[model samples]
Target: MSEDAPTRADGDRDLFDPNYRAAVVDLLGALAYSELRAFAQLAKDSELAPTLGHTSALAILAAHELRNFKLLTDRLRALEVDSEEAMQPFVEAVDAFHARTTSSNWLEGLVKAYVGEGIAQDFYREIANYVDPDTKSLVLAVLEDQGQADFAVAAVRQAIEEDGRVAGRLALWGRRLVGEAITQAQRVGVERDALGSLLVGAPGSGGADLAELGRMFVRLTDAHTKRMERLGLSA
Candidate 1:
């Protein structure tokens, strides 16, 4: 099997369990909404580009996000879940996350696009490990990085090189974005029991326990730190 393909075990058959199915639906719904929001936000942020080349790059990234959104919603439909209805529960929390982390300028926007989204994708990828094989594959595919990381890193690093002061300011912004992302993630897990149960381990849910969840956060933090380093900023 390809390295990118999900490893299948006999346990993957648990996908048919009603509880596991519901959890997968909730996961797909949340992912679908996130992709849609990314598309809109990337398009808006493209307006902050300093040059036509930057503008075109961000526009391409925005298009990728829209395509990813369609992939997720299509998966939800195949499960017989109403895409909009499934996504509705997460709208408020996700919107609030963006509202709290709104960027003040082009560089800040680049940092958020890289750091904020990176942490969220890391968290989802970790969770994917606990799901059935097919659901795991879908989640991994949707969460794949789509060139935004490289673009953001190059842009932010160049800015920092041009103005040393840019590093300090962007470091602070990166910290705020990570904190807010964590808070919003916790809120979602609290409000959405099915999603939470995937980590907390509902009966027959085959989810990770509390210990695993703690370690998951550690991995997330490490990833954020590396991302910050790539941007020429502190974590």
Candidate 2:
């Protein structure tokens, strides 16, 4: 998000421009708050776990998210941006996403966690490609899989093996998660011009075009499908 960085390969140079630097800070703040929120939700969901082992596993995942939050906030501080101010703009939309997609049970929570994280990682990674190398590294690092996938997949698949009927319901829940995510994403796009500019580029900057954004969503959806399949759920 630093304005001192060189232009990117596309010559967009959003990273080095003051206006775009604010956008980058906005993006980082959103990501930072996201990790923190996920941490809280994961901790709350752990209470629904049927076993002590499941509880401990979820707690570990929550810790990983907390660590990611710290990383993001540290970067924001270094950039001299107030992390909370940067995150403020996107808070309502993000909260609405979780509010609408709240899980009804432990299995549903697990599926939501797995699927949601997968899609989000795909998205940020796509955006990172346009950013400075250092910023991109931080974004990718924050999105890195922290052992949550294997645990969620194994737990979910084992549950389905035990009670096959659950798959149909969980599959529906998976679809619901995707739907809510898409809806919220559109909302974010409308509400955050800075973030939208990161995707579509500034008016004259020749950033990512519509076709590129389409392709990025395709990649994200494909990744989401694979993650759902791994969980023995339909996407």
**By TM-score, who's the top model here?**
1
> Which has the greatest lDDT?
1
lDDT of 1 by residue, 130-227 (tens): 77777788788888888888999999889888999989988999999999988777776778887888888876546777898888888888999999
TM-score of 2: 0.92
Q: On a 0 to 1 TM-score scale, where does candidate 1 land against the true structure?
A: 0.93
lDDT of 2 by residue, 1-235 (tens): 4663344552435455777787788779878877888999999999999999999999999999999999998888877788889888879978988898899999999998989756765677777877766788899999988899999999999999999999999999988888777666666655678777878887765468889888877887888889888898877
CA lDDT scores, all candidates in order: 0.83, 0.82
**Candidate 1: regions farther than 4 A off:** 1-13
The per-prediction tally of clashing pairs is 0, 0
Evaluate residue 37 in candidate 2 and report its C-alpha lDDT on the 0 to 100 scale. Answer: 83
| Model 2 clashing residue pairs (backbone) | none
Model 2 misplacement above 4 A: 1-16, 203-206
Give the CA lDDT, 0 to 100, for residue 99 in model 1.
97
- Candidate 1 lDDT at 170 equals 89
Q: Report the lDDT of model 1 for residue 106.
A: 93
